[model samples]
Target: MTHILMIEDDPLILGPTVRALTAQGFHVSQAMDGAAGVQHAIDDKPDLIILDILLPNLDGWEVCKAIRQRSTVPILMLTALSDEIDRILGLELGADDYLTKPFSMRELLARIKALLRRVEMDLQQGRQTDRVQVRDLVLDLGMRQVTKNGVELSLRYKEFELLSLLMFHAGQAVSRAEIFDQVWGTDWLGDMRTLDVHIRWLREKLEEDPSAPELIQTVRGVGYRFTAT
Candidate 1:
């Protein structure tokens, strides 16, 4: 059974959601505040996190940012219905997916299953390759490691995926949509911020000048393109 960490303040939604997930053979841990959510995520390392944007102590945005800095664990944001901006912001802050309020339990279950499957795929793939090098930088796929000029770089999973994708598309621009689809999967319903956050993170890791990155470039209203140059 997959273990899930869910952080939401609503008792009505939380109770039903927890019961539904438990019925489907998921082992779940629940929290009502962002601080607790973050602690539980680090301590328990749940398969995935279902985070609420309106959390107490720390909002989902802060929680996501804090988590992204230290871990690449997949995060699914829970937002209020009609809060499209919140959905987009959550993605920009490194959320892997978002489910608006008033959504069906069936949909949430499907998303959880998909995320767990992707996590498994990433772990399996990590075992297949310890490292991939392009130019002077090295990405250790095995340890989820990266190096710059022979020095190690601590990269989150999404950042690592960004680097891998760029290496695959070396010497050409890779569209933002392609990057998001490849990294987060096509089944994800979140906005394009998922791609944007990862691309930005990758730039900060691999580029000497993130503000004017030479490796990943914006394509001006289209998407991003990455080259080893």
Candidate 2:
């Protein structure tokens, strides 16, 4: 059974959500505040987390950052705030998916399943490659590690995945839609900004100068391409 931790303060929403997930045969855990949610995440190590943006003790952003620093567990954020900046901020902080309030149980369940499927696919593929090298960057596929010029780079989960995808398609311009479908899953409903944020992060870590990136180049209104020279 897949374990899911839901950190939501509102009992009205929480009760039905938990019941629905439980009916789907998921092992569900609940936390009413951000502090408790973070602690449960560290101690129990759930397969995925459903976090709310507003909480009593700590906010969801802080909780997301804290968990991300330690684990690569997939996170699905819930928020009443529909602002684009807030959504982008959650993605920047390492959220895998975002859902606004007044969401249906059907959509939420579908998103959760998509995320789980993506993680499973990555785990299965991890055994195929030992290492991939492009220019000065080396990716240890099995270990999910990356190094540039013999120096290790600290990359988040999505950042590493984005780099791996681009490196796999070196010398070819990969469309934004393709990248999104592969990396974030075909059911991804987030804005294009999520991909853009991850691309910026990869350039900052792998390129000597992020402003004028040579490795991952923009294809002018199309998508991005990796030039392995």
Which number leads on lDDT?
Answer: 2
Per-residue lDDT over 195-218 for candidate 2, one digit per residue giving the tens place of the 0 to 100 score? 889998888877889999999999
Instruction: Score each candidate by Cα lDDT.
Output: 0.79, 0.91
TM-score for candidate 1, residues paired by index? 0.84
C-alpha RMSD by candidate, in order: 2.8, 1.4
Q: Which candidate's TM-score is highest?
A: 2
lDDT of prediction 2: 0.91
Worst 10 residues of 2 by lDDT: 121-130
Off by over 4 Å in 1: 81-85, 126-129, 172-178, 218-224
